[model samples]
Target: MLNRISLRQMEYFVATAKHGSIATASAQIHISSPSISAAIAHIEAELSVQLFVRHPSKGLGLTAIGTLVLQQCEDVLSQSSRLYEIAAESSAAIQGSLRVGSFQSLTAMIAPEVIFGFSRAFDRVELQMVEGDQEVLMNKLRALEIDLAITYDLHQGDDIEFECLATLPPYVLVGEVHPMAQLRTITLEELAPQPLVLLDLPMSRDYFTSLFAKAGLTPNIVARSSSTEVVRSMVANGIGYALFNIRPKSNLSLDGKRTVRVRLAGENRPMLLGLATYKAMKQSRLTRVFMERCRAYISDQYIPGMSSSAFFDRYVSGS
Candidate 1:
């Protein structure tokens, strides 16, 4: 009888899929390239399905079946790491590695409160955090690199589950000396004529632009940047007014320039801040406890962040 598929094969397959090529996977996992290739070939022969499309010049691409298989392999590896934790749970102590990911734009203000606080509470858990854009975070979630992700609920599907912790309403950001800076509330119609500094990230950009469309006005966008701080600094430097949902703890820009946060008026729907996890994936005990910490921190922190400044308009009339 043919030898059964091995755990080592699954590990090699997962590494290969994550790194995109045998050579790169070998380098990452400290395995020989030929060994990795042989392991993948044996699995393909056993399963009778092509896991990856060979692109000599370009890198490996997953076949449709391979995409599904990758999820299984990742889950297996993730669970293997958690096995120690599960075994240790008999001692009534929650101690293990907790890997996490989050949106890059949200790291500064969020990391200290959530990630740091969690670490303090769970003195035994080893926490790992990786910051990336929305696409990168989603990819990591699918690949099981993170136990769970703290991110905006911009996209949701059957493949993932998002639990909303807070709602951030969109608002206008302006320079400290701008004419509208002192206003308690300003409508999109009035702000549309001014030069705009767009944050210009994928889903976020679409959401901000859609606000103008709903108001039946066209924005005169003059400057755009993918970096959140770049857009904020531009606004602080009088480049243009920008729209944002998250309110920083301070009004100062990266370079110490002051910016004003004005509450937006009209029918603006809030963006949800939430935790995203893969559907059907097993949650570790540490993950469950960390999730509770996340919920509690956001419960207290979200409202305060919104209420601390002019960024969110919870009380302004006609908002």
Candidate 2:
């Protein structure tokens, strides 16, 4: 009978265990305290094992059996989530809400595709996007403010998990008239003399600055903007050159200026773009498939910022 306990009971059990009290669990997940107690009572009675050792002075402490039961409850919940995910994927319609966070740079590049693209393909899905720098985005993920994030693998922590989809190799961004744009491949040193249009966001700023630092030089940054589009527009108008990893399908700026993406002729470590989620939380059906959508986007090169023909021409033919 205990083995047949329902998922709701297990949810109450896990929530109670995490919060250390039935009342706390009630507040945590917005269930009544008595309901949580009743679920725990049912599980204990059916199993004929003491799940928690109670004390008047203390709230609740997991007995040896309780500890083991908690682990199993968590496992069950995780598997149950997967079961739902599988079912949702098989049906003609997938219905749920997805809250997404992304690094500011990737948002303009990837958001419309994931939000509107999936909405068109699937039966129904409510989509939301939050854009920020690396720290802001990760903080939201840890606090459970967002379901998942799409960003570079700039930082890794124990509380988070990153599923890498594709790699964005570093390249220099220049205008059509920039001297370096004429070359097949430009070296960082040659561009050092020109003013730099730095993309001044948190981790992103560091990344661009390091590119010059790695080559034993410093950038003469004349313009700085937190916005990726502004940086690109600035460079396209020939204010200064910039560095970037990914190239959009259209090289022309909004103002009808052509932006040049020149491959760097140096040994540089490339940045990886992927999905980030909390390690402990079980992924909902919406998030899992949305992640799949992102992975598919990479494979199909269906993103506006990335050119499909260019990716295939460069990676597929050579490999």
- Position 243, candidate 2: lDDT: 85
TM-score of each: 0.66, 0.66
What residue runs in model 1 are displaced by over 4 Å at the alpha carbon?
A: 1-93, 300-319
- For model 1, state the Cα shift of residue 78 in Å: 34
After superposition, candidate 2 runs with Cα above 4 Å error: 1-93, 300-304, 309-319
Per-residue alpha-carbon lDDT of model 1 for 72-166, expressed as tens digits?
88887688557544645643546789888878888877787678766775577789999987777888889999989988877656799898876
